[model samples]
Target: MLFVSTMFESHYIGRFAPSPSGELHFGSLIAALGSYLQARARRGIWRVRIEDIDPPREVPGAANAILRQLEHYGLHWDGDVLWQSQRHEAYREALAWLHEHNLSYYCTCTRARIQSVGGIYDGHCRRLHQHADNAAVRLRQQHPVVSFYDNLRGEIHADERLAREDFIIHRRDGLFAYNLAVVVDDHFQGITEIVRGADLIEPTVRQISLYQQFGWQTPDYVHLPLARNAQGDKLSKQNHAPALPEGDPRPVIIEALRFLHQPDIGAWQDLSVAELLRRAIDNWSLEHVAENPSFSNALR
Candidate 1:
């Protein structure tokens, strides 16, 4: 088993990567606040990455809007924002390396075909020797990852079949897969920790597998509880969740802190955002965060 150290080191680098498909909503704020607080608490670098690889789904000015929202909430990140759209060459290089090592193969199976097989890929094209034309590239799951450790959630085990499936690295539409791009970017950024929502817990195993394949160090993970609506649905762009308020981010910030189960800071209501953040960083504790899937009263 590959052991990941949770001890704070000088190379502690964390990131908050958000897709530019929509504006920053409350759910997005929870993730951003958790990541920012975790990085600041550990005296690590907090970086932001714009996941704009999917051009068709991206909004025209969502990326800039996200940055402005973060600024408004005083969630300033370190260094220049890394845009995934600009890192295509790096992903291409990584894919080429996998192919060169015979760790990847061209897959011609369509979504319908996969659905016919109960939705899990059965390595249909592993030995088909299919050409790359009109085919997606899949990583051969030689050492399948079944489970991984989360700093906050303990040991998380994934579905056995899904863990061992030959998943796509490059889509048939010539776009990079989220799993592939995230793994490549995380490794490239030298990320020491990943602090995001609990909804992403399942993907941790796959990412660890990718790290091992590339002979890279895997980072520690902390999956924060997701903020959900009263109807038990996660607050997301698809759900038409309202975006963060444009001005006076104090209320939202306090609400987010309360959602995380942090100590009450009503006294800091009149303080500046910077001061509140400083207090938050000093008082942040992963142990205080709830482990449930959703916080029902998060928005209240």
Candidate 2:
């Protein structure tokens, strides 16, 4: 068990970072609720971050819509929302540091080439000394992470091929990769716990390796069960998941609680959002959440 010291509890910081590709959906609600409840339960800070690094994927007004939805659900966040687009300089500095320490290299490999030689990259450009003008920047996997532990899912082993591959930090198009940007931002926010979805479990080891490379502390991870659609696909913006209802968010919030397997509190249905959330935080228990992802009936 991961022991939480009193000092740590006093400084516990968690965040809900959603990519602004679309409006908040049922799955997004679950993630935001879990993180918010966890942070508020411990008297910690719950922050919101708009991951708008990829302009092509981001919806022009989705960030504002997401914030409005959070407010509608009474998920008030602490401090200003951190937009990834505004943190380019920080990512650049981190990338420069890695380059100076010989921890990163420029890769000229294309997607087709990587797919031709198995899906995982084989570090073809690790020793090529290629120029960065038109190439992507990849981190040299000096100390590959084989496995890591999750607070909810327990032990998780990394894929051998993925663990050893030289993953990209900066794309050839000059956009920062998710792994690089996430690690940098999490560390910048002094996040003590990461409460997210199980879909992101695969990247835990890679993030851990990055933490090791940068000599930063790895935050505790709690991957909540994902909410899958009737088609067995995880509900996501790319999957055309419907947006959260605009008006009274009571039903949606209750559904989220049920999804997390929290004890029934049907009588509290008439309470205000703040009161409902207060009761939820009081009775929140990680043990109640199922280890496996659950099918979401919100669409039905």
Candidate 3:
């Protein structure tokens, strides 16, 4: 289904939802600066959301350190931070809505079973109506999104087979999956614009479908290119990307701004944190940003 809604009024609400898997790295900074600058460029409200729903994957004290690093780098977010872990009730409500409307089902398929078949999940349990207590909550693909238009990247499409697959909403272990949580959270916050990493482009289709299922408005999406490592792997916690330095954060912040295509405040290497951000905010521009990935090892 390809239903297009009018733009999200560029009243511009942008956000950076970082997982507390480890400390913020170069990739994290790129996404942060990109979203922040884009929001500032439109005179929008930039918010911070901590995606910490999976307790086992979260590193102790990592969330606090992330907030500290953002502060040190002068990425001031509006409003209090929203934590996914604290919003289980909201997730529960979403799940219940799906269940009542026959939009969701319980699946007992194990990872091995799905892998043996293929990475794509076949709707093995869609007709069973299995009890929710002993299975994972899966979103039935009632209206799969085959294509959609991205603000930065034109007309995007997903693999038809994968797009039609029934993806999990709540894991068998009982935690809300990322797709479900992110979609619900965005709606809860009344997010108007989503400016984040380009890697998320593929997932936007499914998330948009969920929005349609729930009769909620889909926000405008702008996916910025990723930060790559020396080997060209995406800079991520899984790749052992180094954490941001706790010392003076100006140079790194400047690099992030430049990477985002925002104007450079010359020789900001010696400027105070406040002054650096002042120049950055004054000169922010999404048009200057590169549409391709920026490789770096500074934030390793």
lDDT: worst 10-residue window of model 1: 1-10
User: What is candidate 2's lDDT per residue for 140-251, written digit by digit as tens?
Assistant: 9999988777777677777777888889999999999999999998988889999998788778778989989988888999888778899989899999999999988988
Off by over 4 Å in 2: 1-10, 291-300
How far residue 44's Cα lies from its native spot in candidate 3, in Å, is 1.5
Provide the clashing-pair count of each candidate structure. Answer: 0, 0, 1
Looking at model 3, report the run of 10 residues with the lowest lDDT sum.
291-300
Model 3, residue 125: displacement in angstroms? 0.9
The positional error of residue 103 in candidate 2, measured at the CA in angstroms, is 0.1
Judge candidate 1 at residue 123 and give its lDDT: 94
TM-score, cand. 3 vs. native: 0.91
**lDDT value, residue 139 of candidate 1:** 95
Off by over 4 Å in 3: 1-10, 291-300
Better of 2 and 3 by lDDT: 2
Per-residue lDDT over 11-119 for candidate 1, one digit per residue giving the tens place of the 0 to 100 score? 7889999999999999999999999999899888999999999999998999999999999999999989999999998888889899989999999998999999999
lDDT of 2: 0.87
Itemize residue pairs with steric clashes in candidate 1: none
